[model samples]
Target: MSNRVINILVPVISILLGLLVGAIVMLFSGYDPVNGYIALWNGIFGDSYAIGETIRQISPYILAGLAVAFAFRTGLFNIGVEGQLMVGWFAAVYVGAAFELPMIIHLPITLLAAALAGALWGLVPGILKATLRVHEVIVTIMMNYVALHVVNALIKTVSNGSYKTEKIQPTASLRSDFLSNLTDYSTLHYGIFVALAMVIVMWFILEKTKTGFELKSVGFNENASQYAGMNVKKNIVLSMVISGAFAGLAGAMEGLGTFGSMTSLGGFTGIGFDGIAVALLGANTPLGVIFGASLFGSLKYGANNMPNAANIPLEIVSIVVALIIFFVASGYIIRVGLQRLKKKKEAK
Candidate 1:
């Protein structure tokens, strides 16, 4: 199968398999799988409220997925995406709250601060890898904890030990009450457009630009790239910075669009690590990441709604997500299934 086809189909099969296995597990546990799934579906897609939630969920998943996909292309494992995201969230919240500028100026400024902060956070691991010969995976992992502690401390200091920052100015906020007219109650915003734009922009750069070729070359063979006079160190740092920027934007979306402001919202923000699964499932392409993110987002959004209506637990979503990750990581099974599917079709 072609990479494109596998990229498109693998996630679909993985999701179906996950749901099937989840149903089995539910049955064994004495729970009605159907009712649980029904409730979940209602939670995110049953009503206008659910649709809004679905779009809201997609915001973070999109950027975080892009973060991982970008780093993967450069042969870097940015475990520090969480850290970068945290710092970016902090910067956006802090700057957004501190300022009272016009909407046009405030919005861009807050977003830029987030991107810059994330880039700075990523630059650390990048430098460590380039100059100290440290493995980015290790550095990024440690940095996650470092960033958490640092942000926790900052939040405490700012709010006199409070757990969160105050709400941002209206100009900096992304929500539209007009959306409330469309849906009774929904937190979804137009920030999803920004995520989509980023996906397209990232895809263009990686597929059609010289810089992208340089980064991919380094990923394929650092030694060969260096021999070919490519700047390996530069590319490594650049990749990390770009990856971190994406993560930052993800957190920013949550703060500005979904949550209305940034609160001390990191300890439980598993979205960074979740991006790994999203990237792998999508085969690390920009377009693929968007679809992967949307799938995961929908399941999460949908599962929440199912519980209220069907007496099902929302935690099923987590199990389903885990299964999707596992299958995507081991993709040969998908290839085998495709081959069998083709053979059966040919026979028919």
Candidate 2:
């Protein structure tokens, strides 16, 4: 089989294996796997509200996946997306609640503020990596804590020691009355359009731009790119900034669309961490990220129905997701097995 075919086949096979394993686990636990699966399916697609909510949930995942995928493409592991997203959320809400500009200006400015905040947060680790050879993973992990504490402090300062901020003004909101009504009063918003636009932007930058070539070349080999007259350090920093911008946009989805406010968190949101899985499942491609995000979003949203509809525990869905991720991570083994099978067929 061709490499492209193999690439596609790996994930498909992994998904099937995951579901099969999940079924076995359900059987061992004395629950009906069929009912669990049916509940999962219905939760995602049973009603207009469910579909709308699923789409809303997916919008941020798409951006989060893009953030991680962008960094991976440029040979960077940005674990700071959670921190960046937190800061972005705070920045967006701050702007949205403070300003009273017209919709055309207020919304764009609020969104831009969020992206800028994320980019700035990402810049520190990028600079350290490029100039001092510090490992991004270590720096980013520490930064996550910094972002969390700092944002929480800022929230309390702004909200007079409250845990949440004020709701954003109407002009800065992404909510759409028409869409809400169409979806039976779901929280779906215009953030989906922004997420889709960024997908195209990522594709264009990676596939059609000169900067993209330099970034990829640098990622493949810094020494070789430098020898070929590319600015490796610059590309590295730029890649992180761009990745951070995508992460920030994800925060905007929550602040400007879903919640229209910011809240102090006792712990991590897990969305940024989930981006790692999404990027892995996507094969680190722009188009692939959407598919990964959709699968993840649907599974996460649908998982809620298992308990109510099938008497199955919610933890079962988590186990299934974990198994799926494990299979995806074991793609090398699958590929090797496929290659051996192909060789045997050719020998015959």
Candidate 3:
């Protein structure tokens, strides 16, 4: 079989295996997997509201996945997406609430603030990695904590000790009454359009640009890229900045679209961590990230109905998702097994 076929088959096979394992677990636990899945499906697609919410849920996941995937392609592990997202969220909300400009100017400015904040957060690690050879993973992990506490403190300061910020100005909000009414008053917004635009942006940058080639070349071999006269350190820093910008847009989606305000969080939102799985599942491609994010968004939103509709634990869905991620992570094993089987068939 061609490698292209195998590449396609891997995710399909992994999903099937995950569902099969989930079924077995459900059987052993005395629950009906069929009903559980049906409930899950209904929860995601039973009505227009469900569909709208699922799309809304997917918007942020797409940007987050792109952030992680971009870093991965650049040979960097950015574990600080969560931190970057929080700072972005705070920045966007601050601009939205504090300003009173028209929508054309206000919305763009709010979004820009978010992206800038995220890029600045990412720049620290990028600079450290480029200049001092500090590991991005460690630096990013520490930055997540810094972002969390610092944003929390800022929120308190802005709101006078309140846990939430004031409502964003209407002009800056991504929410649309038309979309909400179309989807039975679901919290749907124009953020999906923003997410889709970034998908194209990522694709165009990686597949059709010289900077992207340099970035990928650096990722493949720093020494070789340096020998070729490419600025390795510059590429590294640029990659991180772009990746951070994507993460910041994700936070903007939540603040400007879903909630229209920033809230002090007691813990991480888990969106950034989930992006790792999303990137893995999508094979770190822009188009694949959409599919991965859709699946995750559906499962996550639909899991809420399992307990009520099928008496199945919500944890079952989590297990299934985890198993899918495990299989994706172990894709090499599946590829090897398939290749061996092909060889045996050829001999026969």
Q: Over the full model, what C-alpha lDDT does candidate 3 score relative to the true structure?
A: 0.91
Tens digits of per-residue lDDT for model 3, 160-234:
999999999999999999999999999999999999999999999999999999999998899999999999999
> How far is each candidate from the true structure, as Cα RMSD in Å?
2.6, 1.6, 1.7
Instruction: Assess the local accuracy of residue 175 in candidate 1 as a C-alpha lDDT between 0 and 100.
Output: 83
- In candidate 1, stretches whose alpha carbon ends up further than 4 angstroms from where it belongs are 1-12, 313-317, 324-331, 340-348
Position 175, candidate 2: lDDT: 98
lDDT of each: 0.83, 0.91, 0.91
Runs in model 3 lying further than 4 Å from the true structure: 1-8, 328-332
* Selected candidate, larger lDDT, 1 vs 3: 3
Worst 10 residues of 2 by lDDT: 320-329
State model 2's lDDT.
Answer: 0.91
Error of 3 at 237 (Å): 1.2
* Tens-digit lDDT track of model 2 for 1-348: 777888779878888888889889889988999998899889999999999999999999999999999999989999999998999999999999998999999999999999999999899999999999999999999999999999999999999989999999999999999999999999999999999999999999998999998998898899999999999899999999999999999999999999999989999888888888888888899988998899888888988888999999878778976776678667778988988887888899
For residue 19, what is the lDDT in candidate 1?
74
Q: Which sequence of candidate numbers ranks them by TM-score, best first?
A: 2, 3, 1
- Segments of candidate 2 deviating more than 4 angstroms: 1-8
